[model samples]
Target: MIELSTVYFGLLGIALITYATRLSGLIVMDFFPLTKRMERALDAMTGSVFVAFVVPAFYKGDIGVKLATAAALIVMFTTKKILLALTAGVLTAVIARAVLG
Candidate 1:
């Protein structure tokens, strides 16, 4: 069995890396300026990253995740409101799991 300290340190390392990545942009931007093309690429990169993370999970996840994703997509597209879409999706997954259990 792995020791608790090992797990704690591993999690700490992950947290530090995440924090550094999030802050690196601001730190570098302080001295370096972005061109319009670079800025647009950065804007698209976030969405691409989000999709990269989510798309694989959507294909592999459970029924609840599938239903929630479908509901969120439909609502978001129809209404063009992210908050409501997110709410509807989460509620759908929670209720689906509760009913299933």
Candidate 2:
């Protein structure tokens, strides 16, 4: 039988491993030289990761949440107002939740 303390330590170890894996690129990438192709690949990877993170949130989300977030993103892109965009997004989510529930 696993002790509770052992389970806690196991979970903590897994969390640490996950964090380290994510951070390893940032920590180690600078040590190596990036070729021109590598640079372009990195740039494309960055955009792909950004869209991958954001797109699902929009498509899989409720209509209100998607609309609110899309509006906030558009406002941010057009006006370059980070705070306002974030506020709008949060407010939209809250309002959507309230109304939908």
Candidate 3:
């Protein structure tokens, strides 16, 4: 029972809010100068996100997770390719869970 006008206005509101938020970030960054420490912190933030995701798995995950992590590390060290290693690790975990569980 939703009307077209309602959907249109809802989408327009979302677009306006998203654009304003992104534009505000650009405006603030333009006015500020990035220091060396700030640059390093920003760089580390990227890896911190991934580490945050994996750290929890190590703490509470089953044997499948451990094997997957070890496989991922081995592939990363051997091939030096992150995407391939991640895919392999995920596939390994899926297969391990299917077989073991």
Candidate 4:
């Protein structure tokens, strides 16, 4: 059995490491002047990172998850609003799961 404190400390350590890694990237990038190419690469990287996180889940998800992803994508494309898309997706997943269950 795991103690709660152990879980909390482990999560804290992970969060700190994550923050450090992000901060290090920003610090390192500051040393170099940004070129047009670098700016484009950075812009592309954001989308790639988002896709990297989302693709695996989409691939392995069940029907509810698929529906949610579809809903989010449609909302995102139509409204171009991230927060609205996310809300639509979450609501879709909840409603889908409840109805299916």
Which candidate number would show the highest TM-score if scored against the true structure?
1
lDDT of 2 by residue, 50-90 (tens): 89998887788886778688779988998899999988888
- For residue 46, what is the lDDT in candidate 3? 75
lDDT of each: 0.94, 0.86, 0.90, 0.92
Q: Estimate TM-scores for all models.
A: 0.70, 0.65, 0.60, 0.69
TM-score for candidate 2: 0.65
Which one wins by TM-score: 1 or 3? 1
Model 3: residues >4 Å from true position, as ranges? 1-25
lDDT of 3 by residue, 4-96 (tens): 999999999999998997787578777897788988997899799899998997879997898789899999999999999999899989999
Per-residue alpha-carbon lDDT of model 4 for 1-101, expressed as tens digits? 89999999999999999999888767877787678898899899999999998999899998789999999999999999999998999999999999995
List the pairs of residues colliding in candidate 2.
none
Output the lDDT of residue 26, model 1.
85
Stretches of candidate 4 above 4 Å error? 29-43
Pairs in clash, predicted candidate 4:
none
Better of 2 and 4 by lDDT: 4
Which 10-residue span in candidate 2 carries the lowest summed lDDT? 62-71
lDDT of 2: 0.86
